[model samples]
Target: MGKWTNLIKQTTDSDPISGAVNTPIQLSSTFSQADFDTYGHFDYSRSGNPTRESGERTLASLEGGKYGYLFSTGMAAISSVLFIFSSGDHLVVSKQVYGGTFRILHDVLPRFGITYDLVDFSNIEEIKKAIKPNTKALYIETPANPTLNITDISAVVALAKEQGLLTIADNTFMTPLTQRPLELGVDIVVHSATKFLAGHSDILAGVAVTNDDELAKRIYFIQNAVGATLGVTDTWLLLRGLKTLGVRYKRSSESAQTIAEHLQADKRVVQVLYPGLSSHKGYDIHQRQASSGGAVLSFDVGSLENARKVVEHLEIPIFSVSLGAVESIISYPPKMSHAELNSEELLEVGITPGLLRLSVGLEDVEDLIDDLDQALSYID
Candidate 1:
């Protein structure tokens, strides 16, 4: 219960009826009531289910939060949080967030009268300048998407408190093991559970955890109203994935550090963006907040031609989109994750064609390095 491995392993409450070690999935859509006057803990599956409840409780416990809500997808969970704010309410968001998140804030939310200003959260002063009277929240992704940039959580939380603004952080990269935003005073934490949380890349789920009871109440209402609750089967699958996160993330991160160092030494790579490297600009601040550098890293291969050659020729990692899988994944952000952004928007966020993001898996470091070396050799 105290450590991460224990936290994940013991998430399921044992079945009292069957004496089973794991929590059994309650797949029924409705539960029979004991009497006419009293309703059971659950009524309809959309509002709540036993399997989803167990997973939610575990997620909340892991993040040191009081409540957790499950969603069918990461965006659904994030959208639920956004729905809490009304029209004319504004938000300050990190500039380099996931492309889907960017699209929602930039393209979708504006239609509903909600507005956001994307700012470089790495610079605390810049964040201060971006805040306005209408700003209701600050949404950020630390170890930001594609770029791997780090933002100081505690500092931002302090500023948000002073301004009476709620703080939400996407903790998908670090997971609860490496970084817990709630512990650092963030109001809410969101995760794309398909990543490290599920490990196997099999489930598409999202979770939001919060320490504030009031916020949790509002979030749960939105989740039920939107009807995006995670199904019983996926919840069970996600639970299975959570059990191995500690070991998988540790091994992957170790390999990623080795690969990042190897790539940094090569003349073909202009830059390796991993907080584990001391050369990374956010290394010191990252070390202060997170327990490890995490398993995801990105590098600049100098040009679009070199980047494409390296990804297409790589034999080990899948040169595909999405990350934090048991198998290594290499992605071209400009075309895949951030594809919605046009050339101008891409440049503003620092996503370039030369940049390739790698999510190191539980593969041997030497093998990964060799695969990368061979792929890069073809670039010249």
Candidate 2:
């Protein structure tokens, strides 16, 4: 079946009892055991729930993986994955990773005796230089948060394989619709399903998928042990949201390309960072790996003052933190998404004070453009 067809069909599961089109949410915390010796498929909600399991299986099928796990939030999924490694194991991480992931690596993981080296993933040689003998995995976020930097997934995976290290990728920005990193040889693929997969900003969720049986077992163990699994209600909502992902992503991406071009041509904009723009450093590579430029773009307006002026004056996109919604959102990295990083650390990753990340939505392209024009007029 085609991807779009599979998207809708895979997410739609009929209720066995009522034959309802939507997957039924099983809210029971515990199920009756037929016998003490033999438990049913799901004995406890924390270990597994019908709704969450259905969603997880669907996600695995979509990402072309053998196993899938869902969590209460994106961070929980990521943190659970990190728990797979033993104490003293090291990792090679993308420098432009999301703030929460960075916090995990910088603040949380170190206390567990896990060390990581931040490297510019665009430069494969830098990644090689950063890898130590203890490095067990390579972590990356292609079209990374805020900056939208692209990393060659296949290239990184190949390098990791040569060194006998696992390759983990955060596929939140591109999602499976645009780029399936697992298909590109990534060991595991993770997503903040709260964004594109859910399509609406109404839920907080995370997903992880893997093809390796052993890795899947480890992740499931961590998920069951940690008990941060997604609630049945949120799982049902996420499934409903997945049905419309194709349409939502297509419309948003088309609008994002138009907006990126508009921002690129504007004199008030210092630089536009979007893979859709050919002028972008990683445009060619991105085209090779992904289907679209995605629905997010970032631009620099010269200084923090200019950024604030444009953000405050913007009447269309709301000034907010999260992205991938029916409504457009504009966020300042220095204060919002990447706020955990200090000034020097942010600049080192090219997250300047003037930079503003915009998540394009379902609004009329012309109307969004007009709104942006009016906002930029206040910049100068």
Candidate 3:
């Protein structure tokens, strides 16, 4: 990751007019035409903006992809990639995905005749079993949302390639620093740049990167046609955040592993779901593929009342919705991120009433542990 730190630090060198060290935010909605019969590289803001382009270029380079498209939100990024599939197409998705993603697959896409099968990727046999004649894509979220389930990217990509299906991976949790899906043979890698890439919660953004030229073109077209492109200011903000991603993630991951171990040893804690822990089922595979365990983890407090008490009592981490910020985020996934699911659906996906997700921040590990210990004391 030291190499990634250096790579991210290298500025875009794109300011031809000002020759500024920092990338300039091109706020103009429309660029001037050079001649009566020709146009410049950028014609309109929705299609292309210098600021957004700079961010996209950096992201594409980080993920080792040919092109990257920025979007208004994480969902927008995923939607742009999925838009490539027409009606009557089918997709194979991971069983425990983000609630928003599941909602789109279950509620919205069906309206257009697109169908999906949610399979437990922990068992690759299930993924193979779920594939069918109409299945055109394999959508995966490794170290999956809230549950921390890790899938074998290389195996899935190979299976998809053999089946003549495109592979799409949601790399939001790990980012390119820890795991690069494109390099692992995934066709498309999407991110909720609002999380770790931004490194702070101030801006909302998303990015989709791919090595395939045709897929990139389609996503770029959808980005413009759907009109979900990111704004000039937030694009620059994400660029600033990317500069320190390596250092921030490294520090936060150390703290996350520490917190996960601490929670695991406590009698009141029912389970600690972190790939960093040896007890985690995905620990070995995650270690093989990712540089680190990443900065997020989940634990159960054994009861709904205990979980509520801990959230109400914790002082350092914010009891909030999103994750991967300067301040630690302690969220109840069953109620927050995966609220779209009912009690039965939650149980099916291993999200219990007492399950809580923790996004380790830049806070001192000792401080986070102390704060969590005091909060857990309230459970008894």
- Top candidate when judged by lDDT against the true structure: 2
For residues 143-183, write the lDDT of model 3, one tens digit per residue: 99999999999999999999999999999999888898888
How accurate locally, in lDDT, is each candidate?
0.92, 0.95, 0.91
Please report the candidate that would top TM-score against the real structure: 2
Model 2 agreement with the true structure over 163-212: per-residue lDDT tens digits: 99999999999989899899999999999999999978999999999999
User: Candidate 1 vs candidate 2: which has greater lDDT?
Assistant: 2
Better of 1 and 3 by lDDT: 1
Off by over 4 Å in 3: 12-14
Ranking by lDDT: 2, 1, 3
TM-score per candidate, chains pooled: 0.98, 0.99, 0.98
Q: List the residue pairs that clash in candidate 1.
A: none
Clashes of 3: 0
Off by over 4 Å in 2: none
* lDDT for 10 (candidate 1): 61
lDDT, candidate 3, at 180: 81
**Superior candidate under lDDT, 2 versus 3:** 2
